[model samples]
Target: MTRRPTQLLLATLVLTVTVGGCSNQNHTEAPPPSGSPPAPPTTQGQFTLPPVSPITPTSANAAPTGIPPAVAPPQVDAAPFNDPLRVTTAWMRQFCQTDFMEPINENLSRAATYATPAATAADITRGDTTQSYQQMQQQKLATRCDQVEASINPEAPATPSMVYVQVSAARTQLADGRPFQRLPLASTRRVVRGGDGRWLVDSAVDAG
Candidate 1:
């Protein structure tokens, strides 16, 4: 049978994956019993997708090999040319490094701050997409993973206000418990430029 997308599978297939790794959210709850099984429901080996190129952090479109760069390059030969790559990579670092803890309301609020005005809070929370990160908070899962890597989807369509970049990360720990062995996964995120000329994540299509 064809595999489901990584976003959906990752959410249900279960793990304490880096908390901010996927999408979906819920109000805070007491921590689930320790070793209570990483995810509420998990079915492994069903979701899959073709691989994209690995990110090289030292150059353009590189995801942080781990702990993203301290900041974007101060100068670019041209603003239009460098903004997409530089901004997208920087956002990925913040996106992946979230602590996945309570003030559940505030965590979700902060996560959404990166969103475009047009992006919906509902979708960011429980929309039918690959992210289960939002809902993961409801379970109060703890994690030890930090860092991420991403690449520019040169082929993604763009407009004066919008762009897209694809990112991939590997889950190396099971501190939370999951149905499958640690594996690499990816997502194609949509970003938009705000009035301030700052780029923010508008939304994303997980490999679902």
Candidate 2:
């Protein structure tokens, strides 16, 4: 009867150990399967931006490389008519020629280039007397036989821009090479600086 009681107690102990082992296996975590992908990580409140390219700086007035600069045109020199005495002498030689062979209007036109508008008008009016005198000489001689010789004398002026000139002219017979007129004609001329910075004959008046 004592052996039966000990065997019953041992049976109860084995049943309790088996039940505890099954409960522990139910609560424990299971391992992942072989070759399966891992779970993704959490990324709350975080972001990544794409990369940006760098910019090159340039100037507004800078010329581009590998091109040549433009070349400037060559400049021309202007005619010089700066002197007072030189222009005055040139004017007299051009205007006072007593050539009946050359056209008088052509001579006057060339002379007007060296004078102002007022001076040019005055010179044209004076040319009428010269034309009449030349006609009279041509009728009397019946050939081109007379020429006028001129003498120029300049007086000191009040200003650098103005000059007073005295002209003495004589009519000579080209055939005999002697004075044809008894008295030499006298005249006064005024030369002044023009607006364009060149010297010009401004006026001429017969002297008494």
Candidate 3:
């Protein structure tokens, strides 16, 4: 009877030890195999993005490399008769005619627009003397004369404010319908800027 009880107690102890060994083996984890790929990392709260390259700022008017920039066009003056050559040429064309039939006062007033006060006075004095001689010749010939054609050639010299004009004039006799005379004249004219920003003839000298 004593041997039977001892055998039963030994069997219970062996079963308890075997069950504990099995429980410990099941709870433990085995190591991964050699050369195996690692598992992907798990995200916890928020995802982190990869870094990006920075961009550089550029000017609004900047031109690209190896390219030329755009340029504006040049401005041009639009004033009328603003140059010495133009004003001198205009004066010679108007007063170089042989037909002095217009009134002396009207002619002098018109000439003053192109010439200075002193120059206009001097020119009128010379014109009155010449007209008296021409009138006497017309009366002696018993014929009236009128200007038929005129030509003007202007030359600009090294001086910027001066110009020389050459005039070729022809007159015809009204009675006989024949050519009356030819008057070739050369004059030096100086121009100046007026108060109103216009070019005006300041003085003139008849060279012929």
Root-mean-square deviation of each candidate, in angstroms? 24.8, 40.9, 38.2
TM-score of each: 0.43, 0.43, 0.41
For candidate 1, lDDT tens digit of each residue in 1-208? 7666987787764665555455346546689888786764542334232233554444333432332222222233234333655554544433333333434433334445455545547444553232455555433332222345666678878888787777655432221332122334456778777777776666766631
Q: In model 1, which regions exceed 4 Å deviation?
A: 1-82, 97-101, 105-107, 117-123, 127-140, 144-147, 172-181
What TM value does model 3 have?
0.41
Write model 2 residue lDDT over 36-135, tens digit each, in one string: 8999766323321122233242332122222212112112212324665555545554454444444554445655666667887877776746666566
**lDDT computed for candidate 3:** 0.46
Model 3, position 146: C-alpha lDDT score = 23
In order, the Cα lDDT scores of the candidates are: 0.48, 0.49, 0.46
lDDT of 3 by residue, 68-139 (tens): 111112123334257655555445444543233445434445545556687677677666455664553443
Clash number for candidate 2: 0
Candidate 2 Cα outliers beyond 4 Å, as residue runs: 1-80, 129-157, 168-185
Measured with C-alpha atoms, the lDDT of residue 70 in candidate 1 is: 29
